[model samples]
Target: MRRKIYTKEQILRAAYEVVATEGFAGFTARNIAKRMGISTQPIYLEFKNMEDLKNELLDLIFSKLKNEIFPVPHTGDKVIDLGLNYINFAKQHHNLYLALYVDEEGGGKKMHDFSFNYFSTLIENDPQYEGLSREQIQTLHTGTWVVVTGLASLASSGSINPTQEQIISLIQRTINNIIAVNETVN
Candidate 1:
């Protein structure tokens, strides 16, 4: 009998499906192989180890998110649009978003940096926040990330039961509050 060969992309895609559907804990060579209807050896051939596969999958996940959220000018207002898009992505791909952002272990520093940079760019260019200092802008960026990630975590985990509109509104209000405080302090 001959063994079937699987490409790295195929293994990573299978791993994504496994993680998205079954959570990070369910991501294993055996499980991914089973999902792909092949033996575990194919996965090993494609990845050095499970961690390698996870790293690749994380990259893929973040790439998709970046494509989906970035590169569009927020005509209404950059900050508000960014927050709305963040919440909308969370709701639409609850499991993937959880894996990418909420799952502590899987959601590594790269994901964090990607998110920070994404919002930081929005804050830097938005006319509404033009007067914010570097430190104030940094604070706003970090605070928004925390609020949005926290909101997604809470909503996904059933800790907060707000509708999508309500969640987006809350995030917008929080960002506004942060800006107001920054304005008074500056």
Candidate 2:
């Protein structure tokens, strides 16, 4: 048989499939080759090593998630949409979400930092949070992060099937409570 030449992208995609289906524990050259029905030689040829492949895979996953998962249909309210989008992502990409958030080796801290910085920027811009100082906004961001993370964890674990409306209400309430407590404390 002629040698089947696979592009780096193809190998990376196969690696992604391995992770998506079996979690990060299954992310290996052997499994990637099996998924693509090719020999591990192709993967080795396309990437420097498994670590390089893993780093590239992580970049691809982050890009895919940032692009595909972060954009929510406008609810005319961006802050509420942030919480909704997070839950939706967990529901849609159960294995990937759990692997990233539930499994330590999946780079949970990286995800958390990325999430906080990203959502905090949006929260800073929302008119609803306009009068809050930067410190207050950061406090609110931390609180919102906790709420969103908990909801996402529950969703990923299949423990909760919350409607969009219900999630929106809960998020709104959480934000309000955090702001109220922050204001009271100050």
TM-score of each: 0.82, 0.85
Stretches > 4 Å off in candidate 1: 1-3, 69-75, 157-165
Q: Write the per-residue lDDT of candidate 2 for residues 4-119, one digit (tens) a residue.
A: 67999899888888877788888788999999988899888888998799888877877776677775665866667777887787887888777776776685677777776776
Which lDDT tens digits does candidate 1 get at residues 1-186? 995668888888888898888778788999999999998998887788888888788778777766766544443767656766776677767887777776776677878787777767767777877767878878887877788777767766677777756766776788788878887887
* Predictions in order: lDDT: 0.76, 0.79
Error of model 2, residue 80, in angstroms:
1.7
Clashing pairs in 1: none
Candidate 1, position 17, lDDT: 91
Instruction: Indicate which candidate wins on lDDT.
Output: 2
Q: How does residue 170 of candidate 2 score in lDDT?
A: 88
